[model samples]
Each structure stands twice: as structure tokens, then as C-alpha cells.
Target: MNSASDLGALAHPAATPAALPTFDDVLAAAARIAPHAHSTPVLRSRTLDALAGCELHFKAEHLQRAGAFKFRGACNAVWSLPDATAARGVVTHSSGNHGAALALAARTRGIPCHVVVPHNAVAAKMAAIRAYGATLHHCEPTIAAREAACAAVQAQTGAELVHPYTDARVIAGQGTAALELLGHDGRFDALVTPLGGGGLLSGTAITAAAVSPATRVFGAEPAGAADGFASLQRGERVLELAPDTVCDGLRGLLGAPNFALLRAHRVEVLLADDAATVQALRLFWQRAKQLIEPSSAIALAVVLANRERFAGQRVGIVLSGGNVDLDALAGLFASA
Candidate 1:
């Protein structure tokens, strides 16, 4: 991967509150990233639908650029920069998909991109980030370590920090998926997505609130890393935990902005365990003929675990990513 240590600081325009993105921003993002990001297809599975008792409309974000919906947010952040600042570069800290997605987005703009990644992040995802030509800095898996490392990189490199989930631009970018999904033909009763740092879920909530107010927005999270669920229950954001789930991408604490927006939209969060996620992964692969990472499978897991919530309704699910490490596949399935 190529590295540019010193692109030199450049002036960046400040964005005002009025400039904050709304549903219209999501529509614009779809147009902005259309040339680069794929408008991934919506999939269906008769067998799975019968099993869950819901008509499922799966937004195949696993087929998205960078193999995840993170690309949407990353693409927006990279493109939103002023020409002078973009020339200087962009930086972020991520467990995996966000970093890789940002790197891919930066590559298109021909700018320097630096990623501070947790050491425990998936190996294949790390390789993907590096392969996209971003400079990598390893950090302890804790949120503090990732933030400190990312801050140091930005200070040293003069790269704008496009946080994995907290930034408004990222959230606006992530919403475009649902905009497209909900904009399609039928009326959806509900929309479900895996909640990690809550970028995808936050965006979905924002878009659903505007376009389909009647459609409930649901967030599915791992039981082992259920702070997001906990936060939503307590009516506030919560501290981080040392996550112990197979969904590596969903381990982080909920971002404050994400928390606030989720509350604003009254988004409902559902929890699923590692075993249920594993089972969902297998079912998706076998029935849909599609491979989704454990993080992505959590949405489906929640749906199956609580069949009544989505029963006899048209529900749309955003399959977040498909960047699982190949070597760990057998162990993941066998252990479950």
C-alpha cells in the first residue's frame, strides 16, 4: 500500500448547522456515490421467509463496495471534503470494514488515507484495508486506544478525521441504502439492520422517519456486546464493554450522535446471542446462496429469535457486510 506521511495542512471550510444533512442529504449521497458505489440488489428467500413468517426484502450490502454498507458513509466523508483539504488527506479508526471502505474511497480521490485499526480486527479486513493503499497503525482493541491512535495520526498527518460512525456526514451517507430500499415498490412494515457503532442503524432510522414514518426501524445487536440495546433501554448512551461475541464489527460502544438520533426516531433495539448469529449465517448461506459476516447475520438472528415482531409483514433488512476471514470460518461454524 502507498503511504503519504506529509501532504501538508490545508484550509477546510467550516460547515454550519443549516448545512447539516437531512433526508435530502441522503438522496444527494446516493447520486454522489452512484458512480463509485454499487446500487446493490434486494434479495429474497422463500424458505427463510416461511421460517421467520415475514416477507423479507434483503438489501444486499454484502455486495456493496468494500463488501459492506460502510462504503456509503466513507464515500461521503471523502467526497465532502474541500478540494484543498481533500488534497491533504483523510484519517479514521476502525475495527475493519469502515477502515477498508475509507481507504477505497480515498483511493478514488487520489488522496492519502490513514487507518488506525484495532489489533484484534479480522485479518482479511486488515489485509483489505492495506491492499487499498492506506497506511495502517495498529492499536489496542479498546475504544480509547483506537481514538488515541487515530488522534495522533490526524495531528501528525493533518488528515481530517472521519469517525467510523459518530460523524454526521457518515450517518447521512449510510442512510442512502434505506432511501433506495424504502423508495422501491411495496410498503414495508419494518426495517432491521445490525447495530454496531450505529452508523447504518442511525442512518436507517433517520431515513425511515422521513420517508416511511409508519415503518418501524429496528436495531439488532449481539447479546455479548449489548451496550447499544442497554443504552436504548436506559434512554441514554452507555460506556463501552470488552465485547465477547463473534460479531467483531459490532463490538464498539454506541456513538453519542448515534444514540441521540436513534432515540429521536424511537428506534427499537433487539439482542441476539453468538450462537443465534451463527445459525443465521448458515441459514442465509444455505437458503439465500449468499455469504454474510456474523455482524450482518445478527439482524436476521434477531428476526428469527422474535418471529412475532415481524410476522406476516413486509420487512427490509440491510445485510451490512461480508468480509469474514476465511481461515476462521470452520471454527466459527463448528463452535456454534
Candidate 2:
């Protein structure tokens, strides 16, 4: 077993502020990911805009290769590794999509991949991870258990740990989505994305800060798992969470580096109840004709909930993922 000090080192924030990736790094990541990642389309819905009272630009990352924006970070992390280190393969702990993303990324590079997964992860995501040929190590849902499992795998296989978030390379990779989103003609007043570990939100915030400083970045989170909201308010990373939301993908603990980036960029965190998220999920499906997870739906939910602030403005949203389990949809929505 790893010592408490070792785990503490892994959990704590990096000391130097320079650890955050620069805008130039995001640009480099965009070029690096071009071969493996897709430039997901920017979609607009007349009905969605009318409902939200804003010109909504949706970055359709759900249609990405691994069914989420996570592939951007995962692919970047995998390829960033030196040939010698990459040959040893890679490992990580994830609730679902990140695991699947990393697994697929490793496959493209002809490498072995291992993932430490919680038993409660969505079935469809778990299936996708295995389909990508990654060996799965099941563990309890708690962060401690997940990290321990990941460490064990790393120790045994000599694999490099590509953390789901908090890594500079991963954050840069996640920022590439926003780089592409901002590359379009319109200038957005606010951009929103679902926040979990803060990889996507931090990356997006970093990109927005450089590319479009006037644009405010918003993080939509489940009220039941409102760590991001709590952290931003308290000015520190908060991990004590008893997540009880239907958006399984947004339940991960907030990341330290991710918290620092959000703070630096002054990103706003918004909360929505599980019921509202479900309602928004249906609204997105009906209006935009896109099948997104409850996590992604929450991004639009917060904006719609605060329509007055965004009225007659331009808004950009990252439709983060679409890997929800169809079989569990009935029960998930019924709970709300």
C-alpha cells in the first residue's frame, strides 16, 4: 500500500502557479489533437435560442470520437508521453467517460491501458471502456479507494498515471475544445460547461481568458454534488461530497489544479437541482435533436434558469458527453 504522505502529495495542489497551461500550450494541443480528435461541430437551434432568450452556440462534443470532450484530454495525455514512457502503457481512475477516452487513446497508439473504475459507474460507459481493450480494476466509489486501486495498477504494471484531471497536459487538451469554439465568428458573452473534477471547466476558462477576455466562464453543477460551487465560494478546493445527483458524470471530486485555474480566471459556478437537469435534458433533446447526458444538460439548464442575465446575448455551451445508459434512463428521470 502507498503511504499516507504519498497519497497526500498526489491529492494536494501543485505549489507553482506556472503549472497551469498557457494559451500557447492550448494552441499546440489543438495542432497535436487534429490527427486523432474531431473538430466537433458548432450547432445552433432556433428553438433553443428562443427558449433560452440567447443566441446559443452548442459545441457538439458528444459526437466526438469517444462520445465526449474527454477524448481531447485523453488523446493529448497519451501522445504527450515520450516513446519510452508511453511504451509502458497508461492508467487512471474514472467514473466512466475518462476511462473510455484514455482506453481508446491508448489503443490508437498501440499500447496497453488499465482503468480503476467504481462499481457504480454507468454501465454503458463501463462497456465502452472494455470495448476499447482496457483492463478494468473495480473499486469502491470513494476517492480514496479509487486512488488506491489506480496506484496498485501503476505499481504492478509500471504504467504512467494519466490523471482524469489536475494534470497540465490534460487541462491543455481539454482547452482545445474551447479554442475551436472561440475560433468561430461570433463572440460569446458567457460560456458554460458542466463541472466535475474541473478539467473541462478549467481548460475552457484558461482558453477564454486568453482568446476572449470579455467572455465570462460559467460552470454548471448539480446542487446535490455542489463541490465546485462550494470551492469557488470558499476560495479552496472542496472534496467532501455526498453526491446524490442523476448526472453521474459530474460527481467526481473537485481537482486542486482545476480549482486554482478557476480562481485565477474568476469563473462563476452555477447550481441546478437534479429535477431541473432532467427537464433540461428533455428540452435539449427535443429542441436541438441531440442526445446528451444529464451532466451536459445541466450546462444549458443554468443558462436557461438565468435567462434574464443572458437575454439577447451570445452564449456558448459545451455539450460534454452522450454516453448515458439508455436502460437506466427510465429510473434516472423518474427520480426527478
Candidate 3:
């Protein structure tokens, strides 16, 4: 078991915070992803503002296709592949959102999609992947096992590997959320995103640094899986506690490329306990009337916990996804 405290010390062999992508990289990414992604809505919450002591603007990516911002990057990666490369289809290892997103994207591009999914992944997400006509390859729950299984699948299928987060094209596509948020309104003092694999937040940092340079970018992680926070403090990348936290979507460790971009941009990382995240998720549902995943609630948790930091300022938050199961949600927020 990896303690949150020990995460700072776990050394990643190839970890280094260099090669931050430039504004041009983000611009190109926006162009590449624009055709495939929706310009998701920007939502404001009066009740949430009252609670957090800040004016909050939410980029409602949960309303996005495939129910998450993951679709944007997935589509970009799939489309960017050469025709010959895409002929064999694209493959990735994802627990849920990315799998479905890639499946849908590949279907659009007239290519096959293969997703290596963990046996314990959310049932709804798996169903979505199947609905998009993608083949599923099951794997063990561990990150290493997942990666290994993906490699085996790629070798057998001769598919182009589209990593969920690590690839540059994917990062660029993820950055489009920040682009739309800033483009719609550059009034935010800070932009906060849940730090899962550091995909959207890294892209957020990249885009914010370019268009809204004055706006600070921050990442929120589950306290139980605070590897990103630890890595930032240690000046290196670190892996998370495997299979920890109810925020399953945010379980992945910060990828090397994302860690590098985050460090270069000096993105602040914060951790919220599962209790806090659950409360925030409930609050968003009850008060804001917005459906979101626990990972999405981490951003609001940070604002509510650290009022002084965001108080009276405009803060932009990305509502990353809303793919939670109905039964699970009933259990989560049932009357006490």
C-alpha cells in the first residue's frame, strides 16, 4: 500500500519537468480538435458562489460527448493518425470515459477500436464503449498489469496505440477546454481542474498560460491518491496508490509529459479527502443542479476549503465528467 505521505519519495525513472509546449502548440491543438468536439457551455452558480466565497464559472465538460472532456483528446488522437495507421484501428487502456470516447471517435473515422479495460471498471462506461462498437479486452486492476495487457493487445492487433494521456496530440486536444473557457470569458483569476492523469489540467495550464497568462492554474487530487501533489513538491513524478479512492476517474498517476507541463507552469496541486469530495459532489447536485463525477467535485472542494485563495475572485473550473452509475449514486447520496 502506498501511503499518501510516501508518494513524494517514490521516484519515477524518467520523470523530468522540461519541454513545456508553447502557445502555438495549444493553438494547433485547438484547430485539430475543433472539428470533432463541441464548444461546451460555461455555467455559473449563484449558490456555489455563496458557499465558496468566489464567483465560480464552470466549463461543463460533463455534458460533452461520451460524458467527459476525454472525448476531445481521444478524437484528436484518432483523427491525427495516418489512413494506413488508422486502418488497423486504434487501441488504448482505459477504465471508462477514454475507452468510450475513443470507441466513438474511431467509429466516426471508420476504423476499429480496441480498449483494454479493467475488470472492475464502471459498468455504465463499459456499456458505452460497447455501444460505440469497440472490442473490449479485460485486464487486472493494477496500472502495470493494464499497461502490459495493452502492449499485448497492440502486438496482436497491429493497432496504433493512442495513450489516454501521455501523448502530445492528446494533451493538445485536452487543452481545448481551457481555450474555450478563456475565449468565452477571460475574467477568471484562476482555473482549477481535477488532477486525474493530469490530462485536462496540464492542457488547462498550457492554454491558460497562453491566452490568460494572468490566470493561475491549479490541480485538485484525492488526498488518498495525492501522487501529483507529492511529485510537485519533490520536483519529480510519482505514482499513485493503486486502486484507492471512490473517484475512480482520477485514480491514474500523473503522466510524465503532464507532470513536466504542470511543473513548468508552476501549477498548484491540492488534495481533498474522499469525504470532502463526496460532500462537494452532493452539493453540486443539490445546489447547482449539475450532475458530475466525484473527480469533478474536487475542484469545488478546493475552492470551498481554501476560501481565502479564491474569495471574491472569478475562478474557472472544469466539470470533467458525469458518467457515474445510477445505483452507485443512490448508494453514495442516500438518506443518512
Candidate 4:
């Protein structure tokens, strides 16, 4: 089990605002990262829309740089660094997407990138990170160990840190997903996403509130790793989780600032297990003809199960990433 200390937690001051990345912050980040990132496609599936009882506009962020929506946040973070700081390069701890995003973004800016990755991280994503020019630091599986490792790396190398989901800049950058969704079509009645460390969910809240105040923001999480739902229900942050789900990317707990943001936004969280996620993934593969990770499938499952909540409404969903291991995917449908 990866301890909480293995995954680096963002250091937040006591006075940090729970309501963050105001519309201005999002707009600024969008402007900063616009030239570097792609306006990933918005996909529509009539069958899916009809089945879910909603006009589903899927923001295909899986097609974004580094095969995930992570690039936007990483690009904004790296570019936000001053020349003196950037010269030392940027560092982060990621299981996958953020590492590759940071690596690719850093490469574009002609700066060094260092990623502290778990030994068990997906090989393809690790390769992507290295291919994009980031040096790799292998770490223990526990969140605690990951954090301890990152601290040592930052201290030893003097590299500026770009936390995966907790930093204000990163959160602001993530909000652009919502910005693009809203900009493309500002008529969504609600925005839904999968929450791991709250990057996408926090951004979704900021964007939904700004573009459509009445548009509720929601998150779907794996039942076994449902810390976000548990924490939201407890009204206090939960920061401990064992990495034990098919949705490997959604293993971590929500960050301090991110929890605060979700609280401020009053975001609703739903829990779905691996079985439900797999079923939803298969349905998407067969019906929508889309390939999505287990975490992304959680969002789709929420829409499918809570048909009444979203019935007759238009909803925007961010299909965050698609770096699934094809070999492992066979097992997902073998029993079905």
C-alpha cells in the first residue's frame, strides 16, 4: 500500500480561498496556455445521448496532448515559472498523465523536466514521459513514499515543483477544459467528470459557475477508492487511499485546496465500483465507439444510472484520458 507521504501533497496556507480560479483566473490561464495546447474535439453520440436521456457533449480530452487533458495544466505551470526558476527546470510526481504532460510541455519551452513516478506506473505513460525529455525518478508505490521522494528530489535538484492537481496555477489551467466546453457550446445544464485529486473537478466547478451558474458540477469516483465522495460527505478533507482499482489514475485523494474548492462549489460526488466502470466502458466501446479509461467511464456510468437527474437536459462531460493498456482490456470484457 502506498502511504499518504509517498504522494506529494500541495502546501496550502491557512488563508487560501476555497472558492478559487475565479473566471478571471481561468481566462488568464486559457490565454497563457492557448498557444501551446489543442482545442480537443467534442464528440457526440446520438445513441448514447438517447440512452442517457441527455444531450451528451463529450469533450474528448483524451485526444489532447500526451493523451490526456493534463497538458493544459502542465503547460500553464511551466510557462508561469520565471526564467531563473525555469532554468533549474520543473519537477512533479505523477502516476502517468501529468508526468507526460509536464514532460511534453517542458520540452516545448526548452526546459528540463523531472518526474517522480511509481515503479508500478503504466509502461507506456512512463515511456511517453521519457520520450518527451523528462528525467525519471522511480519511487515507492505509497502516496507517502512518493511525497518523501519528491521532497528529496526538489531539494537535491532545485527544480521548481508542479504538483499534479493541487496548485492554484494548475487548477486554473485545468479550468480551461470547462472554458473550452462552455465556449464551444454554453448550453450544458450540468458538467460531470471523474475526480481523483480534484484537478478536473475543481476546474469544472470554476468553469460551470462562471459560464452557467445554474449548471451543477458533479464528479464520479470508484467505490473502492471513493475518498472524494467520503470526504465530501464528511465535510472534511480525506487524504488517505490505497491504490486498488482498475481506475489506477483515480487512486489518489483530493488535495487540500481542491477539497476546499469542491466544498465552496458544493459539488456532488457519486460512487461507482470497478464492475460498473467496466460495464460502462464496454457500453461506450460498443455504442459510442469510443475508447476510454475506467476513470472516464465512471462519469459515463453516473449519467447512465442517474437518468432522471440529467433527463431532458444537455450535459457536458470531459473524457479525461485514454492511455489504457490494450492487453489488460481483454480481461475487462472477458466476463461480460
Candidate 5:
């Protein structure tokens, strides 16, 4: 992957320090999205915990509205807009989860929503976006194409842009998941969440920093889509790479503001290979009796892979989403 020395030169500009989301924004987002977003339950599995040699607290975001934690950010963004701006509508580019989430959020406010989706996006997720009453404009599966499509849609519709990950409002909204998890119990030794565009992980890190200063924050990334890991290691954003992973939800490049927040909080990222992620997915389904997508399962895969880091400690893992295409389940498990 090619590294960008100037993070601001990336597609998304680096956020100014004052524009970055804070714990206060997270707190406000919790209240703003309280009525729309679900306070998903935290689950436990003794068998799995024993296998990993750590106490696992699963924040079940798969049960969240629109079937993912993306809803929290989407809902917050949709609601935070002034009435005049909201009336103009909202637009975003998402592979799947965020598209479906923005659609649902816009519906709640009775506004027009447009999603710029890649041609190669998961069928189930595309269906979900359409089902939620959003206009879907298909584009090639490249960042440039997606952004161009989104820009065109915004120009034509005069819609406000609610970027999937980089927007401060979205980051604040995403933080609510970790906020809820930490609030549900006492302090945890560490918190882990899947890292895609860094929205969820950045939000989690911010929440942990403010609420539980001692808790370490970790990001679980698919080895195939390890730009977040590379970016952190090199102290610059890695902007070029073709992600080759079964974790479809994590294919996006890490956003500039998202990277900034993560770096500021000193977040560590761990990698999980596709085979291990699939195995972790199967384990969660069979042992926890809960169905989670490969993207979500990677968090557990990292924990299991690095047992020494988390052994005998309480760890919170955010199951980011559950919007997998049911038709492909057999193929995914068969490979594992």
C-alpha cells in the first residue's frame, strides 16, 4: 500500500482539533439518539471465555436498529441537523451497513435520503437500503467512484453530506456504543472493535479515554484490509490498496478525521486473517448462539490470537453488525 505523508491530501481532509468529536459530543449523541437507537444488550459466553482465557463482554450491536451500530451515528447525524438542512435531505456513500443505516435514519425524520453504493456491494445490504426508502445510485467499487457519485447526488438533490465515518457527528454517534457498554458495567481492562473506516474504533477510543481512563483501546482489523494498522505503525495514512477479504463491511479506507482521533487516543490495532475470522464467526454462532458477521467476529479472533494480552482480564468486544447475506452462510462456513 502507498503511504500519504500528508493525511490532509487524502480524500477526506484532516479535521481541525476543535472539530474533532469529544466525550461531550458523545454524551450529547447518546441523548439525541436515545429514542431512535436501541441500547443493545451485552452478552456473555462462559465456554468461549474459557477458550480465550479472558472474560468476554459482547456488545450486541447486531440487534441495533437497521441491524448495526452504524445506526447510532446515522441517527445522530440525521437528528442533529437543523430543520432547514434536514429538509434538504442527507446523502452518503457506504458499501452496505452505513447505507442501510442512513436510509433508516432519514426515514425516521421523513426526509429524502440518497445512498451511493458500489456495484459489488452485498445483495442483502443493497436490498436493505432500498427497503428503507432511499434512492440507490450504483458506482464502481472504488473510493473515487463512490465519492464522485455521492458528490453528483448531493449537487442534484441539495442534500447535506453525512459521511459514513469521517463526519464529527457520526463519530460522536458511534461512540455511544462504547459509552453504553462501559456504563452497563464497571471498568473493563480493554475494549476492542472492528476497524474499517475507523468510525467505530475512533469513537470507542474516545469513550474509553473519557469514561475509563485506565482501559486500553484496541482495533481488530482484517489482515487483508489492514490499512488502519499500517497507518498507525507508519504515523501516516496508507491510502492505496485493494482489500482482499471476506469481511465486506471493512473494505473502506480509513478516513482522515477517524485516523486523527485514533492516533490522538493512542489506539492499538491487531490483525486477523480471513480463515481465523471465519472460524471465529462459526465459534460465535455455535457457542454463543448468536449470529455475527465476519467483520464483527474479527474482534474475537484478535483476542483469541493474542491470548497473553487479554488473559484473565475483562474485555469488551463490540459486535459491530449482523447484516450478513443469509444465502452465503453455507459457503462462508464451508471454507472455515
Candidate 6:
């Protein structure tokens, strides 16, 4: 694999602009969020390694504050604002994890936050957002509806818009997880994260490029909501998709800036079916004793699906979140 320094070989010259977040931005984010974000542990699972035929290092972001890696980005974005700007508050739209994350981050700064959520959002996650003291605005389960609601909230409150994935600050903040992972565990042949709107994947790719130059970064996406895979295959962003997946967090369309970074870094995407993902989730709970959500389990699912590709390799997997709706667990597992 070409190192991040060899961008000329992998990236289209005009595609990656100077404005995108770099390794320096990631470093700044690490420093900024040090007091707030957890330096989540890199866990090793010998049983999992034996099953996948690879040395697996799991970045335990599920144990992070607000129960997900989304906290890292949300915390950074919330705190990065100047006091004057932050006083006006912050707003964004999310299906679940990011909404809860942003709500908690806003609370940490003692700022008001508004999260526009889809009506179909998971009840447990919505409760988490409400518990964090953010005002909730419900909309139809569509990207357009969410954006419209967020715009209305922004207009009414004059709150700064902290986009879930596309914001440069959020991207930089998200990279800090990989920064911690690589810094603690050293280099790996491959690194994988769950692909939602691509914040984590983009950040991971950036960190891998700069820190572990030879590490290959991969995004594990659900086959039901494989827009990331489709976007890369088409060489352009696909703006709309009615995602049909069990992994609610992975349902968002890929952000433009995130797509650019993934393409620029030559990040490869792998897909796993819902059945396989659920199986992997069960396996993780059984062996690793980690109750990660399906979105997080897709990384392990992809690795298991393509054993030959990762066999005997030191592979790092980010267990993105652990917020599972307990009421729906039986149905989810039964389908598997």
C-alpha cells in the first residue's frame, strides 16, 4: 500500500484540497479533547483472533463516553467553538449516536443543543439524546427532512451547525481514536472501522496515512446500506438512498468531504450482510464479552467473510458503539 506521503500515486491531484484536515489537525484535536474524550483501550481477543485467523486488536470505543466513538468528534466540535459562538449553542441532525454524542458534548460545555432526529430513530438512542438535555426535533425519516429541520433550528436559535461527519473539526476529532489506537498498540497491517457517513473511516485513513504509513485502511459497510461502496465504485458521491439495514447508524449517505478523503487515501470498503453482521455481533458478545451494536460488528463480519485477505495479519478493528435497543434485541438476533 502507498503511504499517505505518496498521495500523488493514489489521489487525483485536484480532488484533495488544502482545506481538508491533515495530521496536524488530528494532533490539535487530540490535545483539545484530551480532558473530555477517553483514550479508549486497544483490546486483544485471542479467541477472536483464532476464529478470524488474524491477530485482532479491537479499539474499544464502545466503552467511550456516551457509549460510542461519536463522542470524540462531537466533543471536539462542541469545544472548538469560541466562547461567543458556543454561547449561541450547537445543532445537528442524527439518527441516534451522533445526536446523543453532540447532546452530551454540549452539556459538557454548558451550552444548549438541538438535535433533529428522524421519527424512525431507535427509542433507546432518542432517550439518550433527551437525557443529555438537548431539545429534540422530529422529522420524517429522510435526509431532506432532517436537513430542513436542522436548518429551521439553526435559523431559530442561531446555533452553530456541527455536521455529524462532514465538518473538518469533527473529522479531525474522529481521527484521534486511531491516533490513540496506533500510538498504544503500534503498527498494524490493516485497520477497519464501521462506515456510516464516513467520519470514522476518513479519520482512520488519515491517521493511518500519517502515522502508520504502510497500514491499509478499510471501511466495513452493510450490504443493505452499501452507499459507501457504491460511491467509491462510481467515483462520485451518491446523494440519495433509501437504506434498508438493521444497522441504523450505518444508514446515512456518505458526506462529500468524507468521500473525497476516502478516495484520496485509497481507502477500500468491504460489505457484510445483515445475517453475517448479527452473527458477528453474537460472537463478539459470547467471546469478547463486548456488547457492540451491529454497525460496529460489521467490521468483524467483513474480516470473517474475507478470511484469506486478513489471515495472519495484524488487523485493528474499531468497535464503534454499544448502544443496542434492548427491546429489539430478540427480533434482531432471531433474524440471524
Best by TM-score: 5
lDDT scores for all predictions?
Answer: 0.83, 0.85, 0.81, 0.82, 0.87, 0.85
Off by over 4 Å in 5: 1-18, 140-144
Q: Ten-residue segment with the worst summed lDDT in candidate 1?
A: 2-11
Q: Write the per-residue lDDT of candidate 1 for residues 1-336, one digit (tens) a residue.
A: 101110001001111212345787787788888888988899998899999998999999999988999999999989989999998799987646888899999998999999887666556767888999999888776556666787798888789988777778888999999988988745799999998778899899989988989999999998987888888888866664546788877876787778787888899999998999999999998888888999999999999999988889999999999987788888798768
lDDT by residue for model 3 over 161-183, one digit each (tens)? 87677767778788988899988
TM-score: the better of candidates 4 and 5: 5
lDDT digits (tens) for residues 39-134 of candidate 4:
998999898987888899999988888888889899988989999999889998875678889999999899999888878766776787889989
Provide C-alpha RMSD values for all models, in order: 5.6, 4.1, 3.9, 2.9, 3.8, 6.7
Q: State every prediction's TM-score relative to the real structure.
A: 0.90, 0.92, 0.90, 0.91, 0.93, 0.92
Candidate 6 clashing pairs, residues 3+ apart or interchain: none
Model 5: residue 157 alpha-carbon error in angstroms? 1.6
lDDT of 5 by residue, 1-336 (tens): 111211111245334433889999999999999989999999999899999999999999999998899999999999999999999999987646887899999999999999887776667667889999999888876657767887898889899988778889999999999999999978999999999889999999999999999999999998988899999999988977557677877777788888898999999999999999998998999998887888899999999999999989999999999977788777777766
Query: Model 6, poorest ten-residue lDDT window?
Result: 1-10
Ranking by lDDT: 5, 6, 2, 1, 4, 3
Top lDDT model: 5
Cα TM-score of candidate 4? 0.91
Lowest lDDT block of 10, candidate 2 = 1-10
Model 2, 1-336: lDDT tens digits are 112211221343343434678788788889888999999999999988998888999999999988999999999989998999898899987646788899999998999899887776556667888999999888876657877887898888889988777888889999999999999745889999999888999999999999999999999999988988998899877766567678877776678788888999999999999889999999988877889999899999999899898899999999999987788878876877
Q: Which residue runs of candidate 6 sit more than 4 Å off their true CA positions?
A: 1-18, 140-144
**Better by lDDT, candidate 4 or 1:** 1
Ranking 2 against 4 by TM-score, winner: 2
- Which stretches of model 3 miss by more than 4 angstroms? 1-21, 140-145, 240-243, 334-336
